[model samples]
Target chain A: MTIEIIIQAIISGLLMGFIYALIAAGLSLIFGLMGIVNFAHGEHLMLSMFSSFWLWTLLGLDPIISIPITMLILAISGILTHYLLIRYILKAKMIVQICATFGLSVFLRSLAQFLWTPDFRNVGNPLLEGRLEIAGIFIGQPQFYASLVCLLSFLLLYLFVNKSETGLALQATAQDRKAAETLGINSNKMFALGWALGLSCVSIAGTMMSNFFFIFPDVGVHFALFAFVAVALGGFGSIIGCLIAGIIIGLVESLGGLLIDPSYKLLYVFLIYLIVVIYRPQGLFGR
Target chain B: MNNNLQKAKLEPVWHTNKFIFALIFFLVTLFFFFPFINPSNFQLHLMIMIFMYAVMAQSWNVIAGFSGQISLGHVIFFGIGGYTSSFFYVEYGITPWIGIFIGILFSSLVAIAIGIPMLRLTGHYFAIATLLIGFSFQIIFQRWDLIGAASGLWIPLNWDNPWLTLQFHESKIPYYYIFLIFFLLSYFSIWIIYRSKIGFKLRAIRDDPQAASSLGIPVAKYKIIAFVISAIIMSPMGSLFAQYILVIEPERMFDIEISIIVLLIAVMGGVGNVWGPLIGTIILIPLSEYTRIFFGGTGGSVDLIIYGILIMLICIFRPSGLISFFPKKILERKKFL
Candidate 1:
């Protein structure tokens, strides 16, 4: 491959990586706060994409314009999920917790199929609908805008987790639930907030990608698999680690597809995941 | 000394209970043959499916339930078995009965190879790694043209000689009886293992690996052994599945859904018990079949929805599984009597 082509692949991969980071951030946050791996995390993303698709098709609202509504819906659903299912299994065995979330994932996917008919739908005549050329490199406008949104959301979440009082409370609860409760932080509320914030990040990603990618009930499976690898590669509870790992996965996928057959793209991503898990299970940025 | 005296007094009662249990089991086995006496093809097909799933679930229970290693990627063994047997039969004209043994050996070896490295990780890491391995295997099989790639391999239908090919021309009875034997063999082996010294060590590892190791238990060795045995038992069902369906594809054979179904069946019936998967198969296969037959747009959606709800409820309210309820109730009734 030419240097220019390599650079192009790198840029695209980086952009896709940002979106992947957004998708994985919620999963990492949930694991960090509650120590529960939300297998339904991908289903939440699928739901948000469907919401965006529906809003665009029915009201002629641009996907960009429906971001807040989609986020609000998903955030509420996340909170409901916490209260309805997750809270009950907080003290349960590890396998029980895992199966509960897995069951929820199955329920959500089938429910989506029942409601939406499993047809792949994409937003038509999206607001950002062209390609941009920057000094001999080409980029899709939708992808660029999606990456921009990803960066902004990541920064906002980082600031929220690191700079705010509520964020501090969430972290305290995650560190030691009983200690946080003793300090009158209401750990339950903090957990609910974690779910809200985590799912909102997924919502933004789903909305942004709705413009370019096909939306379907099972659309989240591949992305969810990638996000799991990213979360693991980044370490279980580290947000920055997830972002970096997500980008790395994206780059590997794009470069691997370019260098080798596209069919082996997932092979490269999984190889990196296995290597990281074996050598550095704590992740790149994890403490 | 008093406890030993009481145990000796109760020995005859325990022996009689054992005899009764065995008699009941024999009767149940006889009952299964009733369907064969005057079988409809559809009913026989469903029976085969139930038996196939029961074998798969029982194998899964060995690792996940007995050893407490929650592997979510067991479909890889199933796929390996299907692929191996089909390849042997298609290429060398080997009988599926013989081919299945080779498939079992192949799957067992792969399980040991994968288990050695994977068993090093604990809990969720092990689960996720196995899942990724399964996905990678599916992707590789999909891309490899030598194994038929995405189009998959098909076992040609030869009606001339049925027994040699392990194919019956018009009688689903043969398939049912074959799978019934598979189920019995799987259950009997697990039953023996559950009562053995190795089974005690496996349960010890499951309950507390650190304590087990402190007690001189070979924790890793036993776990790998359980995993390999589970994989070996799982492969034959895959082989039977291929012969029954007359085709095998990467997507269908290595699908994550198959893994989830097996897991659910084991969990729903009662994990760690020999009868758990059998009970689970009995309850689930019929429910799923009826739901699919009656409610028809894509068929699987409604059944999956119900299954999902049932699983969540079971996990939350009855984590010990439905079978636990029965034994307790039976014990209570006996006490009252």
Candidate 2:
């Protein structure tokens, strides 16, 4: 109710929103271009988190530095996933694609559980341990750094997509694969690039989350649902829409939790999702 | 009606079938009632759990399998039923039997409202929408202190007075039989619907909604109707399960996991095919129970991995589900396929 409390909530919401946007941007891009809802999208993020945790524990690397490593690894993993599994379902029905990806999600989650033993692991990053005090509001140093990283990533992504040839091809494929093929673009390569880029987004978000958030096998399910809600809120397939929607949802969660229990935060956001889908199936920013 | 008679005659004979559903049913029923035939309390408890699961799966199959909506929030209806019956039982001493009807009514009404909005969404959106509604219901239930909130409410476990709304005796055999009857009735109701005109509309919509709509079928109306009818059957499932478990917690009644299990079974069995869920339950339920027994708490999602693999195989190889495993001659002869 007070200005300080509101300011603190807004700060928290904006930071969380950036993280949501970072993770969801890839999902939006892949879904837009491929018309496949990658249920394993969050699993990619989970893998990054685990990798970051291990890197931190073993080599004493900061999560921020581990970000690039995770992104590169995930990019390769994403391409391989598409080449091996998702490529076959490109021409198949949407339900088939959905189930295929959902299967991959389960498989990846099980693999993580088998490997990690379901223990919560943290990235040992000293930078992440610091906090900032601004006008009576305390914000974690890692979160602020993550926010800056998210903004920079978004800007860099925007440039790559808008100013680069491969990005143009990816956009063209997303707009219409058949048309993009007519332009002598290798649509498969474009799809692979899109997939890799999507995973990179997940990697960055995962690294950011691992700094503070505990890494677990099923964490992807939680974030994936929230990302879906964000995508739905923003209008599916719209990057700008996802950005806006992610912020709105982040505010909704942080502020709504003040009125109700935190456990019901997702439930309330889902209600918004239902209402949005019911009223505008195309989403707020979807075309 | 004419087609109904033809389909009725097309029922696969128990002897001709390799699965022997009738024998299995009888054996399972007898096993559940074996305690009553002799008298053992612990074995009877397991029977009650099995019966509850059987009925729960049946209710889920109606919408997820029959209507092909693929809802992941069926536990919402179960929660509605449980809370409705529990609230009335505790406050007014109303028998849960009567309270069950009120539960069904409330559940159906809410389902229609949600369905009316969600039926527009296809595939994953529909699934997510239902999940949201289920989650919302859980939140509301947990927050409303009248229903005991997070602490949960305990219904009196009286045995002697059978006339009371909810009670249990020395033996759990009667509960098992009662659930068996409910399961049979649920199966029969779905069967009848499958053979009915409405069932045809539902299947047509599931196969191809645009084509069905083009053929003058009221697609939206039928989908909502299917949800309503499914809720009517499923709500009582909650009441029965709550009574059997001797308690109803919000999370247990409206668990997201329950919805996933239901969808997983239906998808594994061969969605849109009658007896698919039953067959799936027969195969997978026992395996799951065994996993629980073997690994205890250690086995987090080993079974889920198996189920996920099965779903992938089915979606890739045989989207028609286990029903495709039946012999060609039987499928051709029945013509009910």
Candidate 3:
């Protein structure tokens, strides 16, 4: 392969990976702390994408400008999800949680299909509105903006976790819920916060993705699958792991496409998933 | 402590002996008389489809329901079976009767290959591993042009040779009976497994894997066995599905929706029991038929919405399934001692 093509692929892959990281961060946090495998995570992302799409189409708001509104709406949805569905089952078996989330996923996916009719929807006014030629390689505006947005979101998340009191409380809850409760932190509130924050990441991803790709009902399923791969590759429950894993997966996808048909790229990437699953079940960066 | 609460909440039930016998007799009669009652080609076609899915669901239940290894990608076995048998039958004029055995062998091989690596993964990890396998199969099956690639192979029209097992006489009776046999076989196989010691071990593992392992149960071996058995049962479904439909395509067999349908059936019927799938099929098959009738060829995804809502409601309140709603005595007695 030409060095220029390789460089271009790497850059695009890195950008794609960053967006993946944003999509996955929330899932990792929820899984890490509450042990609730939110199978509907992809649905939430899809929901936000639709929200952003309509916002741009109807009101002429930019995707970035629509983020706060999406976050507010998603935050409420997350809290309601926690209270209405997840809270009662907190003490139930893990299988219950999995089943519940699976049901929720189906519900959300169906709802999307019902409303959107399986047609692909896109955001108005391209996020970047142009492409850049760098070192004899072309880069799209959306890809660069999406990557930068993803990076900034991660930094903000790191700061939220490391600097903020609520973030510390969340970490404590993740480490040990009962212990966190013993320290006078309300674990339930923390869970609510975690859900909101996790979904907020999805909202960010939704906005960014709607700018680049068409939004379909099953869009979340694809992203959620990749997010899980990212989570596994990065190590479950690790933000930094998700970041690195996303990039690795992007490279795998991009490079695999170069080697073979793009449609068959999942074959090679899933092989990596199988190898990692067998050899390092804890993930590459899982502690 | 938690066990005590669970036990209290889930009081077991026992069915009357006469009721159990009557139900079995009714099912047998229903299977035998189904073709006579509705000799129309469409009804038979729907019945065959239901029986095919019933087998698929029953097979999945062996691992996901009974053993508590929820594989969202159980379609791999179905796909393998469909591809193997269809390829052989279409390419070599080999009857699906012979092709079924070959499908079984390949599916079993795939089970062992996947099981050894995946036996260690529990819960979400296990689910993802199976999902990956499903994706891998789709890619492989789609790329392999020898098997007809994405467009898939079309069986040559051969209505003249009935003994060859490749003939189509335009009557659905043969298919209906074949699928009835498939259902009966799957149901009987599950029943046999339910009564066996391995079934007990599976139940124990399903309830608590670590404790089962601590009790000296070969958790991995039993899991592999359960998965392999499940695969064996599903392989024939594929063969029958292809033979009846007169077509075999990768997407038709290996789609994520296929896996989801299995989950829906197993979940709707109730997981971890023999009768769970039957209950699921009884409810879902009719609903599916109705949806198609109402939607009429091309609407939107109204059926998916209805199906999704039904699944969601069941999961929300009755995650144990319709079986949980049975009278206490009946449920306990039928659950297998």
lDDT per residue, candidate 3, B129-221, as tens digits? 787778778878887889988888787777677547744677778777877887888887688777667887999999889999999999999
Compose the digit string of candidate 1's lDDT tens values, residues A1-287. 69999999999999999999988998999999999998888899999999999999889899999999999999999899888888889998888888888889989999999888898888889999999999999999999999999989998999999999999999999999999999999988898999999999999999999999999999988888888899999989999988898899999999999988887998899889888878877777767
On lDDT, the leading prediction is 1
After TM-score superposition, the amount by which residue B159's alpha carbon in candidate 2 deviates from its true location, in angstroms, is 3.0
Residue-wise C-alpha lDDT for candidate 2, range A207-230, written one tens digit per residue: 888888988887887788888888
Docking class of 3: medium
lDDT of 3 by residue, A1-287 (tens): 67777787777777888998888888998888788878888999999999988888888888888889988889899998888788866776665677677778877887788767888877657656788887688888888887888789988997898789889999999999899999999999999998998999889888877888889998888788888888887788998988888888888888778766678777767778778878988999999
TM-score of only chain B in every candidate structure: 0.92, 0.85, 0.92
Which pairs clash (backbone N, Cα, C closer than 3 Å) in model 2? B95-B165
lDDT tens digits by residue: candidate 1, B83-120: 99999998889999898999999999999999887887
Question: Which ranges of candidate 3 are over 4 A from the true structure?
Answer: B1-18, B166-169, B334-337
User: Of the true interface contacts, what fraction does each candidate have?
Assistant: 0.63, 0.47, 0.52
| Candidate 1, residue B308: how far the Cα is off, in Å | 0.5
- Candidate 2, residues B70-143, lDDT tens digits: the string is 67678888888888888788788889989899999999998888888788788778866776677777777877
Ranked by lDDT, the better of candidates 2 and 3 is 3
